[model samples]
Target chain A: MNAGIRLMTPVALLERFRPLFEPRGVVIAGASSHPGKFGFVAAHNLLAAGYRGEVFLTNREGGEILGRETLRSIEDVPAGAADLVFICTPPGAVPELLRTAARKGIRAAFMATAGYGELGEEGKLAERELATLCADLGIVLAGPNGQGIVSTPIDLCAQIVAPIPPRGHIAVASQSGGFVQAFLNYARKTGVGVSRAISAGNCAATAVEDYLEYFADDPETRVSLIYVEGLADGRVFFEKTRRAAAKKPLVVFKGGTTAGGQRAAASHTGALASDDRVFDGMCRQAGLTRATSIEEAFELAASFATHPLPRGPNVFVLTTAGGWGVVTADRISASRELRLMPLPADLRSAFDARLPPRWSRSNPADLAGSETRDTVVECLDLVASHPEVDAVVFLGLGIQSNLGDLERNGPFYPGHGLERVVEFHARQDTRYSELALELERRHRKPILIATELVDCQPENPGPATLRAAGSLAYPSSHRAIGALEHLWRRARRSTAA
Target chain B: MSAGAPPAPSRTLSEHESKQRIRAAGIATAPEMLAADVAGAIAASREIGFPVVVKLCGDGIAHKTERGLVRLGLADEAAVHRAATDLLAAARPADGPVGLLVARMIRGNRELIAGCLDDPTFGRCVMLGIGGVFAEALADVAFRLVPLSARDAHEMIDDLRTQAILGPFRGEPAIDRDAVATTLLALSRLAETSPEIVSVDLNPLVISDGRPLAVDALVEVRGR
Candidate 1:
């Protein structure tokens, strides 16, 4: 019943990796007392996140570590006590420990150790043996050298980092440890929480496609965000990813698009990215959306998760600043998929009642520096409620610091000082969030916001407010319009498939 | 698939034989007969109707237009005879004489090229593109892996960069899109079922009124 997608992999092999995604009982090999060590932190993450399963700590000394009794050897742990083993030992010790894991019948592994295949030929042999032994033992491994894994559905945070982003729909899996780390951090900053995130380093026994297959079935995951520096098996990756994308959105951010990036990727993950144009052709056939950068990838993920699918090409641009609107319009005009709508007669009358006489009423309705909260709400209602408009993009609405100048509009300020001014602006931010959510909910159209306020500013509540309300704000109008374009294109591609 | 390694390319089929092979696969090909003499050419012209097209058809004789071996819009028996004599004499300087390929002249504003190639990485794939004089000048083409479903055929036509040509243009009725899709589907089946036919090239897939008629074709086969 699949439309043009190729299904692959043996059913048994596919099932073997399930424990890696949702393990019931996990144990840490080489669990340490030292706070700085990876084993200690990996254990700490699980405990901190309140993982709802049995967690075992194995140390050679057989003492208590992380308030749990350590198992001196694999034999010390009871039979079938652990379904997943996180091997944190050096490369040379991995072979012997894997033998014990096989005897113990641990179905899955998340190896945190480094210095394996990625180092050189000798290390490659070790990685190859690791793969062969796992296969021989009927075991599926996440990595021989990896950052770690996070399963938000099971409340399992088994990575070295703790306090991962709050639970949400987007699932991320990538070969670059840095990309996964950056994604998780961005998720927290933007409140774009992840269903699951994996830094699939080296990928010896388990490949990237294995995680794609897992996320495809995860009900919590609405879309899969993949960062690719290179692919181990282009054929299998294409087959599985296309199949996954056919079911849901698969937004791919390819790192090795340039010669410099390709070399860096080779050194980082020991992978040679495919030729740019050839890889592009393959993605087009598979119906996958390609984001040019990690930021765009996350922006697109959040946009898709928040907005309803845009059904037509006509887009309504509402901007507080005319220059920002023109810049965004220029960017939108570069793409053929989206178009600027003519100013509807109803919209003209509505804006005329709210704004001064100088408003440009042609197509992209520029508010001409009216930062008033009522102006945005009325414009959003008029544009989103219009029959011909498919999506509305708002620009330069987050610069509420303009409200601090008491001479300009000080009467509106809740009486004096920078602190009161901030409180007043926060109220405006909440109102914008509510207005955006209400309009989108009623109209079933996408609403993208742009702000000039610094995302890192402590006083700025725009990004967090919008994020909490299940919407997102871009730092620039270009990104906001670009994300809207991608969302529309993604919806079309999904439905067509 | 063949029994052993794929055979080497020997030569391309004559246009007449190529048309016959593809027409057997359910493609609507214009009727044509190869004439060896002036009398035979006139007879073929009479049988095919008033205006006829004449071209020198032979193995390894590619790009007959630049070689000036093709004559179109020959209106009568005298015109057909004169064109056939010129084409037959032109064949002498080339890969030698085969015959004068005579067929009913087709007049259409839009031209398209459709073909199949055994791509190295993708295997058997079908290609559809805007053709005629601008084929090489503008490579507005789209490719799809073969055993093409109806949807694939439909998408393949829309995938062309110069999309305006597919619709009603120059006051002519819109080319029958369903027939074009059927042509692609039939060609895909021909490639999949016939392993000996390694590739095919049908240029000037003339859109006359609202239908597609294969005016010229070439099929490459294995072995000498």
Candidate 2:
């Protein structure tokens, strides 16, 4: 029961805000002269992004803003000046503002402020009054506490601030301001950009669930990521999430699992994080992948950006060192609930000829350390072509000690085989790049590379080769598993639909 | 021949009969008399107890909190007499009788709510939620189409925001899931079986130890 209840609300909030964000232009009432105010921030962002439609600003004694003129109230703003008015003022002013806005032909509002329904008794009355005003005037309000919104590339950054670089496939909606910004940074570094980033703060009038329905239809967004504290309606959210998952890759991060966290989350955002166990069951049934952290969230988003989703879970690890291969295989085996089969019988004999006798030639197909770039390429080709493996991971040795200076020393210290080792790595890097480019054309599967060294150079074939496949993050094996899991789910969802 | 059949009249009950019918349905009650005889009322209270809750319990006091017909925690015979006098004065029944009810004071940490309303379109519907301030503050409640199955009743108990309150949290014993389920089931059953009941409200159903005991209940029945 706990699990099911918590899972329902975030989805409900998302469903409620669908119409408010999709309008041609949303006006910010109480469009402030103050520098740090939400009204000022939202207006400045929208205008700078080249909003072509009407943007009417409202205040008590309306006049010119930074450049645009403000109306004497929502009533003074000419009818049809805007489709929606965003109230960034205090809750006390909201009822009157809503009353005036509704009279002047505004049909929707984004109440981007807190202190109502979240601040206890007095605030609750204020919230009820505001609801009454909306009901009377037939206005649709997005929030009494909301982070506003931003639709990328379309030049719609209604949020107080925009942290995303206006490009990418992933669209995100979060309850926390901090989580939303963190994801923006994470996506950029991972080479995955955002299509839209919004924070549905208190969801007084609209919720995250509303935007989800729009995102399900929005062609610009391919993968949808959600970070939630809670929702207003659980069953509505559950049904919508299930429907959205069928169309796009939907990944969610739900906070407030711990009792202390739930209490804090409630006080912070007025979100009731129902029960964790109930939420878990909902995610499973909806086919929505639940990410454990911010890192996993972005990694999963990134994985969906560049790779063809894996169908089932057969992963093959091909490497030059047995230890690296073993660790890579172990990570995948441990993290994924799927089966990782041994290499097929046909590829073994061909795999043996390229490596030295001392090489631990096993399922990972460890090409002897002394092997050249050609051997690495051959192993990948064999591994990728196999019938059993659905995904392939190549482990690259990206760093090697400089041997020129050491050659003067004894056999042990001298670049005894330093130059050869460096050359081997350099060749592997070049060959791997070519392999990555060639594999891109296949499109039937995805192959990723991992390495220990943080910096990969042209002189190092391993690093350069993997870099061609995609970007890399060091010491994030868990992130890698998250990536694979996302791709697998994304593919399965698309196929299942 | 079809036009010859007479239309049925709506059924309505006086306040005295409403309380009597509700008490007969396995619900507890305190001593009280609707008769204008002060002697009979005094006699009933003596048989009951010293401290008690007194209310006008009239059909007109729909929202008693606002109407000022409610007096709580009255102690001793003198206080009971004063409360009864105050309730009678507020009712302003100079012509004949005044309706009043005296109930035992119920104490508990948690307050839960159960309600049923007959929707003009959907027929009967039931609502269950955390009671008291949080119910209105959070709106953390669940609604079901009646008559609710055992699974539906359990889901309502499981889905609310403060569902943790139902379980033993913060050193409290787990709420009797069976009782909660039964209460919801009974409410649904009432809505289904008794078409005369227009709406029912059981606010602050106290959960002591593990069982939820309804201390206060009000039913709105249809009139003929």
Candidate 3:
């Protein structure tokens, strides 16, 4: 294995192969003083990101670029050093760069420029010549029309996009340049830190397969997300993804699934996405979680990173509110194959004795806001302590106010004042936070918390503490339930494997 | 998904012997004449009629298209007489005299392709698709491994992009699907049975109405 890694000389070799995930050094080959040149923008971003690796700028009129030495030719750079070379040169100049890189043993190259293979026969011939050169030298070249990679861990930003990603576990490999940029900025804003992001443009030499192999062993990457336009090699991709699933979760949002999209993908990448049914079967065999949208891809990966995989479908729902329990239960058991097991009779009787008779005795125990922090603590203790409920999803934190008198127009507390009513619902947030911490400390049943109060506002207590307390927090019960289901399936596959 | 193997032609054979194999298989081919003497060659050409194609039929030059050894549209008796003489002189070498296949020209608008490839993983598979350069350009081809069922044949045809071209378009009648399927199956069986056969190309499989005919054929084999 060491020999295999060593025979891959161009220090840029592996980075070129999976640059988005492991770009140690990135050089803009066609940097210029001209503002319009893509190389200028790309170099500016890499430097602005505080990249730690040696940065080189190559251009016709070589000079200082962001306090970095500019090399005029690839020959000037010592071989087996630079990990990634970005080709921001013109379309016609790429073939020469590829040949020069091959001679110098620069394996992985990102072609940020366009033209060739996409044009007519003349362009195809030029592209073919470059491909033949790479094959002969065993150098892996990325796209001539790609937006580059952004790795947060190494502080490597090869993209022209701003703000290098903050280090985290979610790794994204996308074929579309625009999508890659959008995902990175979104991850930063949403507090979902990204580990690595790759934009495999055109995939001339190195392909999605190379990235899959790299991420399989990537320790920083806990879960991988893919935005695929088309697959380069069907059989190799399927096999690699299958092996990858065993180690880390792989979530893919396969773009170009529609007819028009498929055509566009073919023209862009020179690939056939194949039939939809085949893709579905392939994903299933590979143990991949298919996300229908980009948001789901991010949400699913984020949830997986923070939470432990669930054991089974058995769940316990506890809420301070009434109607939310029904909504949570309905979403949890929406699948026909899944059944919502009722709370145990002994547990139900204990809850019934604590609350009024009309509080509704079923699963999703609705305490009707009469519960205190101690009430929440007791409820979570009992539910999580139960052998049947493998996981608990708690809704509505009671930390705000109203320690009691949850039921309005009820004689439980006659003539409850407005201050008392406000106090009753006021402190549930703090109480739920305490209960969430205690449950995690004791049972470790993987509790997922959400509340109606936290649905829109970002500053709810129960959701925040569920996250900090080593449990998952979500704005919606449906998201919490969906995340649980995903974890359950992943656990099933992992255990089976 | 292609099947079967094609039978090998062990050694170089005369044009007459090649025709005999096709005739034995109950298939019709164009007429051919190979006369030893000049007088006899001229007499044979006159008997065969005008507007015929002449070719240098030899052992080595199987890819005649690339060599430009073929002469087409020989109109008069004088044209045939002179062309045959020139071709015969070129065929004569230190080794031996090369025989020629004087065949009638079959004209058609449609060109189709059929071939047998011995897959390393899947064994012999026969392919059927659009003819000539269009097939290569469009890559509108489908393959079925030998010993295919009728359903498989239909599936392969439908899989092709030019499958619509095989159907009734404009005022023309639909091409016979059964005939194409049977040809694919037969090619598959042949390929599977004969490992010695390496490749086969039958281009311009002229189709009129429900009838399809293999007008031009080329076969390549392994070592002698």
> For residues A195-302, what per-residue lDDT tens digits would candidate 3 score against the true structure?
777887766666665676666667677888888877655555665676777778998888778899888887876665655544654565567888878877777887
lDDT of 1: 0.78
- Give lDDT tens digits, candidate 1, residues A1-497: 12323344546434766577678788888888889999888888888889888888888888877788888877676778777888887766777887788777788878889887678677777888888888887778777778888888888788876456677888888887778888888777777788888878888867776678777777778889988777765655667777888777888888878899889888877766765644654566676788888888888887776678888878888877788888878887876588877788888988888888888886678888754657777777788888899988876555564454333355644444666667666667667767877888898988777776636442355555677765667778788778877778777766676
- Distance from true position, residue A264, model 2, in Å? 0.4
- Error in Å for residue A58 of model 1: 5.6
Most lDDT-accurate candidate: 1
Please identify model 2 stretches exceeding 4 Å from their true place: A1-23, A47-81, A99-108, A128-140, A349-360, A371-378, A397-441, A451-475, A489-497, B1-224
lDDT of prediction 3:
0.67
TM-score of model 2, chain A?
Answer: 0.78
What C-alpha lDDT, on a 0 to 100 scale, does residue B50 get in candidate 1? 77
Error of 2 at B103 (Å): 46
Worst 10 residues of 1 chain A by lDDT: A1-10
Docking class of 3: incorrect
TM-score of chain A of 3: 0.82
Clashes of 2: 25
Report how far residue A385 has shifted in candidate 2, in Å.
3.7
Worst 10 residues of 3 chain A by lDDT: A1-10
TM-score of 3: 0.61
